[model samples]
Target: MKRRPRRSVPALLTALVLLATCVLLAVSAIQLILGERPWISYDTVAATLHDLRWTDVLPAVAGGVLALAGLVLLLAAVLPGAATVLPVDGSFHSGVARGSYRSTLQAAAAGVDGVSGARVKLRSRRLKVRVDTTRTRPDGLADAVRAAVTDRLDRIGPATRPAVAVRVRDPRRTS
Candidate 1:
């Protein structure tokens, strides 16, 4: 099942600002209709706008803040978040959580001879496995870990095969 997208911070902030403005305007209009004068005179607002120059610091600061806010919103809208579940195949008819993939890779690497433990990080384009081995020679352990991981990846048959990277570390060195 697909999860709902989380609300973006910029979008939320803009909504709040707009809501507050609407409330204030409504209150002011109500007061004006009852014959009460608005707190800030229209003349004052008109004078401020009239006096605002292109080189003024207030205008520049406001423009910069608005531009930055727009940029952040644009980025948040465009960049997709990490998927909670990955498609077993390109068709996405069946899928599994990302944690399951990591566990599968870790189990495969740990099953390799000389590997005492394994940590796996799976990204969109890369599968990084760090293996702690009992063997003194890192070379043999590294090769074995790579082959086991490669076989596991082939079995999964993801839409794109992530490049497998194996790093072997001595088990004793961590202690």
Candidate 2:
């Protein structure tokens, strides 16, 4: 099952700004109708607009800022977000959370002999397993970890099997 990310934050902010503008305009209109002074001076705004020119530095900077903000909002609305869950391979429809999948692979790698610690990173189509060992010479540790992780992946049966890469690090070596 595919899930789309929510774009509520941008939408909510845009709505709030529009609402505030509308409320301000309505209040100003009511004050004018009652023959009371409005919060903003209309004459001053009209004079400023009349004096303003397209080539003015202030107007150019303001226009650029507004265009940049619009471009950002447009991109946020159009771009697709990363998947939160990975699909599992099976006759019945099922999926697995990325955290759970990574943990399972890490456990498999850590269970191997001579491995002091294991860290697994799950990418779109890559599984990187970093193994730490106390043994000074970790000759075949990387291969062992790779095989174990691959076996676990097979059992889990993800829809897309990522390529497994194992790296063995010796704690005693500074380099």
Candidate 3:
């Protein structure tokens, strides 16, 4: 299977690139804001840079090169295919579909009486259910949710195995 990046990864990478750009900009800003020469003194630069010539300058040059490389990398991210957020199992859209399905299940679960919030997560087709429910567990709320989901799955036919998890996020009595 071909490897692919997650959809959010680009956004994340873009953010990282933005952050890198900000850092570079900050460095440039500092360079511009304070144009002071190196405190090493002109004599030091002349003395130190004179004898070794390019050799002594090599280290500083290398450091500058590295910084430039990092800047290039940040710039490359904007160009596409520079860095990809790999998806789990190389199937990003599948994961997104699963996520959306889980969200639907959660909403359905929340509709049950006594339930405040339902957060459902799917692990390889299995449903990990976390429901914020009021006192009494509302009796069989989990079952109801499970049945609804199973029915939907039957109609839709997911290509992966399914598991169900039910948890009570909160249990409180409400009039």
Candidate 4:
């Protein structure tokens, strides 16, 4: 059985705090039972609550912050991110990482005639290819990149076919 990962920081801090509180309460109870002076008195706590000030508000603010922190930790523990896997052509599905696919697409795009370099972003249903040319601004650069990337995608055989959108960037502007 696969075990889910837990958020340890919040849990550990909460446990430590509760343990300290229990120990303090136990000590106070023992002091009272032994007819000794207790660390905290009920009358002082009541007086503080009745005459609340900024210092009293600090505890409430701290509690609120702790609650928010615990809530975020709980959500993170419960809802984990989905694994990104690209299905390739074969009897057994090959898991391709997102970065690997982007790199493959970039290499394919850069192989085009006038392209000096390429940047590829592979989304769920869209492939954005940005190609940079040194000085040669050839016509149909977008079409060339689209075709090359499309052919590569077909060979890769991802589960879903992403629409290839090509954008050509000319770093040095020529008249």
Candidate 5:
């Protein structure tokens, strides 16, 4: 069975906007057909919509649409072209479980302060998460990464010390 596509904030908001747009257009058409004077300003339109019991509806629909657009923009900014399944030089025979574990690591890495992005690559039971951070110098970054990853692992489950590797992959690019 094919899984249904998960509705993201943007997609959902777009749908709501479309529905609300249809309703507004319909209302406008109806008013035009009935020979009502056109509303001059948003205030008048809002007042009319309020009288027609659509005041709350308009705001709610507009807000949801705006919020969804913001979320989509944020995702695009944070992780552009991120693959659903990571394809790197790695071997995790445990299949899906291993992939999930690696994702967890990546999330943990991302949670660290100053870390812009991180990629947790698991291969042959070895784990490596390269941190793309704004650290000006290569001091205490390794320790900080280790501590963050360890804390996250402790919360995840039984503490099995995986071979933890962390390196600052993205330094401040002068160019």
Candidate 6:
């Protein structure tokens, strides 16, 4: 089963906005019912709305902003979030956290003979490994790192195996 990241941020922001609007409307209604000064003046609002014309720039801009906001909210609500955990092959109930997965790959790459330091990035379906070595002629080091990382990935057996790309750089070279 694919695990998706939580959409709590957008959901929370939308809820807060709606709650504030509802509270403001309810307070204004209560003030009107009690014959007190409303938080928002209905007469002024009515006059402004009545005077607004379709050709006015203010109304057109406001409408456009509202439409764009609605579109963004709709897309956020409907679209699926990124995966938080990758599924394990041959296991329906188990998955690996992306952090741990990357760590494992980094360890595997770093364990190679000439690698002094290693960094791994897993994005979408790509696994990028950058290794630094003290050796000036780091010939075939990239292939070695790639082979080691690939072997570790095979042992882990993730449902969707990412393509591994390895880069070897000398520590003394700035480029």
Candidate with the greatest TM-score versus the true structure: 6
| Candidate 3 structure lDDT | 0.61
Tell me the tens digit of each residue's lDDT in model 3 across 21-113: 788667756765698543334466578656675547687788898898678756555544411221233333433344455666677677777
Native-to-model Cα distance after best TM-score fit, residue 101 in candidate 4, in Å: 1.7
- The C-alpha TM-scores of every prediction are 0.67, 0.77, 0.44, 0.62, 0.40, 0.86
Q: lDDT per model, in order?
A: 0.82, 0.89, 0.61, 0.79, 0.67, 0.90
Candidates 1 and 3 compared by TM-score, better number: 1
Q: What is the lDDT of residue 85 in candidate 4?
A: 59
Those runs of model 5 whose alpha carbons end farther than 4 Å from true positions after fitting are: 1-96, 158-160, 170-175
Candidate 6: pairs in clash: none
Clashes of each: 0, 0, 9, 0, 0, 0
Per-residue lDDT of model 2, residues 90-161, tens digit only: 888888887898999999999999999999988888989999999989999899999999999889999989
Residues 1-175, model 6: lDDT tens digits = 6788777887898899999999999999999999999999989999999999999999999999989988988888789876788889883678888889999999999999989999999988999999999998898999999999999999999888899998888857565
> Residue 133, candidate 3: how far off, in angstroms?
1.9
Q: Compared with the true structure, what per-residue lDDT tens digits does model 5 show for residues 72-172?
A: 76775465342333323224321124557678878988888888888887754457889887767657777788888878766654223467889886566
Residue 111 local lDDT, model 3: 73
- Predicted structure 2: lDDT: 0.89
- Residue 63 local lDDT, model 3: 83
Residue 160's lDDT within candidate 1 is 62
**Consecutive 10-residue window with the lowest summed lDDT within model 5:** 87-96
Model 2 segments beyond 4 Å from truth? 19-39, 172-175
Model 3: residues with Cα > 4 Å off, grouped in runs: 1-98, 169-175
Give the per-residue lDDT digits (tens) of candidate 1, residues 44-78.
Answer: 88999999999999999999999998898888887
> Which window of ten consecutive residues has the lowest lDDT sum in model 2?
1-10
